[model samples]
Target chain A: AQSVAQPEDQVNVAEGNPLTVKCTYSVSGNPYLFWYVQYPNRGLQFLLKYITGDNLVKGSYGFEAEFNKSQTSFHLKKPSALVSDSALYFCAVRDVRSGGYNKLIFGAGTRLAVHP
Target chain B: NAGVTQTPKFRILKIGQSMTLQCTQDMNHNYMYWYRQDPGMGLKLIYYSVGAGITDKGEVPNGYNVSRSTTEDFPLRLELAAPSQTSVYFCASSYPEGGVETQYFGPGTRLLVL
Candidate 1:
């Protein structure tokens, strides 16, 4: 079964410090990875995706993720964290076997807290 | 465009009651989906529709039903709601445009069953 795993339940970092949220996935064939962030009482917002090329992918709100195929990881990163960046982050992988539009299998989310 | 919208920002229901969560996307997306999110756990796909009249079961489709009668509307129905069904329900739509098929989501609906 295709799945994604977020090893950390919560990650804390000081404002203006670099932050990393770890994610690892297991899937057959090529992996299509995605990152989504959810704020309190709100729906998820797409951050970025790793389809084929470019190990490092940039996304919305000054976020970027590096796709490490050998490590089976796609960790989200930011150069400088902000208090507003604190939220729940999820990592997902697409199940390619599904017909038409593939469905996503998500990991247990990780909460990121950026302290001011 | 309003992207995707879900009605009833918050709702509380007694066990055994039923309700329909309305979701509409003005983006003319060909695909729509319904998911339930619980604390700590990531979202679970309840149902999805590829197009009008084309519906399919997803990872977690046991207690939910959906119908896609039009390209813009895909409503999720819960029959005989239970306490376990209490969750934040999110509706999302996506257009398979080019290589990037990004799913745009709505501000979720919080459902609580007593």
Candidate 2:
């Protein structure tokens, strides 16, 4: 079974500081990892994904994630935190055998609190 | 392209009452999914369709039924609603082609069962 684990329930960060939301996955074959952000009373927004190739992937809002195959992790990171960036983050993974549109298995999510 | 659109942004239902959450996507995406989000839980796929006339159960499909009669519409039906069914429901769509794996989500429907 493909699953994603988000270790932190909430992450506190100060403005202008770097932020990291940890995520790990378990998959049968090559992993397709993705990050999504959701604001209060709103739908989820796509952030970034790691399919293959590069270890470091950049996404919207100057956010990036490092995909570590050995550790089976894809942790989202941002150099500078913005108050508007505070939201709930979800980590998802899909197995290769999922065939089409592998139903994304999401983590419990990590709430980000950016204080100015 | 309107991406994905869902109706009834918010609704309050009485226990045992039934309702349908409408979802439509204009992207011609072959895959559509229905997921529920709780207070702490991120998102759980309730049901999904690979294409028209084909549907499958996800991690949580109980109390929910979905039909994909057309490529553009995927409606989720909630029968015999209960308090446990209260949550935010999301409709998502994605293309089967490579690089289109990213699912575009709708604004979501917040349901409260009493």
> Which regions in candidate 1 have their CA more than 4 angstroms from the true location?
none
Predicted complex 2: CAPRI docking category: medium
lDDT, candidates in the order shown: 0.92, 0.91
User: Residue A32 CA error for candidate 1 (Å)?
Assistant: 0.6
Query: C-alpha displacement of B107 in model 2, angstroms?
Result: 1.2
Clashes of each: 0, 0
Among the numbered candidates, top lDDT falls to 1
Worst 10 residues of 2 chain A by lDDT: A94-103
- Model 1 chain B poorest ten-residue lDDT run: B95-104
lDDT tens digits, residue span B20-113, model 2 = 9999999998899999998888788899899999999988898999999999999999999999999999999987435637888999999999
Q: Which residue pairs does candidate 1 place in steric collision?
A: none
Q: Which residue segments of model 2 deviate by more than 4 Å?
A: B97-100
- In model 2, the clashing pairs are none
lDDT, residue A105, candidate 2: 83
TM-score of each: 0.97, 0.95
Q: Please state the error at residue B67 of candidate 1 in Å.
A: 0.9
Worst 10 contiguous positions by lDDT, candidate 1 chain A: A94-103
Docking class of 1: medium
